[model samples]
Target: MWKHFKFDPNSVNFSCFTDEKFNKFDNLLRFEWEHAVSQDLFMFTIDYNAKQRILDDGDLNYIIGLNRDRQEKRRVPYLFEHVNIPFDNKKFHFNKIKDAEVLFSLDNEQQTDKHLIIINAAPIRPYHVLLVPYRELEQPQVIERNNLISIIFPDVANPMCLDSLCDLLLGQIIETKYVVTADCIVFGCEFVAASAHPYIVAGLNSLCAYASVNHLHLHGMYCPGRMFIQTLKCSVFHTKSNCYLLDSFQPQAFAFEVKHIDEFNKISQDVYKITNYLMLNNIAHNVAIVKGDSFSSADNVLRIFIWFRQSITNGEKFERCNFAFLELSGFMTMPDEKVYNTLTESEMCQHMNRLGLSVEEQERIKDDVKNLLDN
Candidate 1:
């Protein structure tokens, strides 16, 4: 018989419940813990008010949350607010490192076998587990020979880094299965709240498999986590086939291409022009142009990816004053298409010029966008 680990939510100290168990939710074996028990161990909860206090320099040694019924409504437990005791710091070591090797390892076999590693960092999600790569690569943009091997070590460091790591990993995983196919990569980003480390937060971005960069190492998907979530408000429709745009009021979107060294020579100018255009327009975004020669294998097509906010809301205030829940998750507000269409050819050209793109290269991108839209 397989042993199942269980935890009691009401317990004051639930450190003993970190074992693996059969989970009914994912239909696969996973580590399970009681919400109350985890609260006791981590010395915090996903409560926005609590996070705000911490961010304002309040003591973070303890926190409280509403019962399930009051969670969404943000109702206070008038009777139980003072009745339920907060977690005690004496029972746990907040600063101590759990097994560092397990938390940060390059070997896939070693990482897959170990139970999740809980770090001293603030928990972004309930039971947030961070896995760090054993070996640290120099410079975030450099591609390693073994793309898969590279991600294994770094995915755990933090969310900001995880976004790029995810892009690379996704591409490699897809290429290993389908050698030749034109796949589209889609990416998105949102924020996560942190109470313990109030100043720090998290974001997530992901892409589909067909996207590729020419370099053997560049063929994988790449994504990174950010500290904030920016969105635009417009009626944006969703489809699995063509790419969709989320219209926003803020200039928070950005996109870039990834190409193999050989393919880079073919589309480098186009990629440069696009990046220059976005940056010169004062768009708050990131563009990663990965080289194929940096790795053993490379994908042919250059991956053009972009992200911008469609809207921005007072998530922090709502979570704290109203919901008491963490403002980690964001809602997508689509923007007006007419606003995006207002950009004139000359206006775009001027933006490109700011990025130092020559007139000839700007014309090429303009021709390319026009052709893309015409088709």
Candidate 2:
């Protein structure tokens, strides 16, 4: 017999993820079918305040019936390992992570002792994996990301270096052929996104980062709905002659892309350099990595978008702040159907205005790093 889960939502450490016993494809197919017949996913709807939810078809009027009593609105939760967020305002006992099976583990071909990927049991999407640093996972501390790197690599002893970590993340990009709703994963703030089978990955630097649970993690899912992989349909953002990547710039939204090894190396190096800069200033940022497909190569092009934001130390957090990586990528997810139904255009503008970087602000950060992000 299958075991029953004992949940303690108030404990702050209880898990919100699960590895479904049913086949993932079948489950998804079933969800799609239900939308075909009834026009809703279990009556849950999401309001992407800033953007319209991508309509599966023009006829998809999947809102629940008017007579149906409104189901208690609930936002899907991130499968994080932690006690309550900044709610308690004091150290809380660690919530012992459950020993559940993950849909996938690390790629056996290139598996390493340094880090391992655990397909989230209660995942936001299929093959949704979390890269857990071993030493840190085993010993759980509010330590810097580099501390885990130094222990794993042994060569980079500096506490601030993020290269090893970056390399590991890059390797993750190489391993998987798919990423999902990065598009669908949005919580209250519509921060999550998952589309069709396209490579989408993002990372949160520390617990102080916005994700619900405060463990260092990289989020990757396949999303095909992303309209703009490269900023404004332009592949390369060059400063003057298209010889070198512009330090920081995007025509519509601030974004950049990398096509070859030399460009990727320079991009990754620029990442660590900027990360160190943010750390010095005690700021936080979100990262999104995009690829055409698993078979994509340097010639096919890969993109990694970084944008600055406030960290927990700076007293910045979205109580219900949504829109993490995928949302930042232009696709957004709203987990509550009722809210999605109710969210008006004006409210959407309000949310968009209050949160995220303004074009002017994006330009400022881009220009600020114009030299730094270029390496």
Q: Highest lDDT among the candidates is held by which one?
A: 2
List clash counts for every candidate, in order.
50, 33
Q: After superposition, how far is residue 102 of candidate 2 from its true place, in Å?
A: 5.0
lDDT of 2 by residue, 81-198 (tens): 3212332223221123332322222211333433333334333433344544442333221223231121222243445548866775555553332222111111100111112233
Candidates in order: C-alpha RMSD to true structure: 20.3, 14.1
Q: Model 1 over residues 1-375: C-alpha lDDT tens digits?
A: 112212112221101112322123112111322322343543344432221111112221112222231233332211111111233333222122333212221111333322122332333333333322221221111111222222222244555577777776675553232122111111100000001121121222111111111111111111111112221122322221122232221222222223222332223333334333433443222222211111112322222333321111222112111211012112111122232234232332233223233446434544544344333
What stretches of model 2 exceed 4 Å from their correct place? 1-112, 134-196, 199-209, 227-231, 234-254, 260-266, 292-299, 310-321, 342-350, 356-364, 373-375
- Global CA lDDT computed for model 2: 0.37
lDDT of 1 at 122: 34
lDDT of every model, 2 decimals: 0.24, 0.37
Least well predicted 10-residue stretch by lDDT in candidate 2:
183-192
State in Å the error of residue 264, model 1: 22
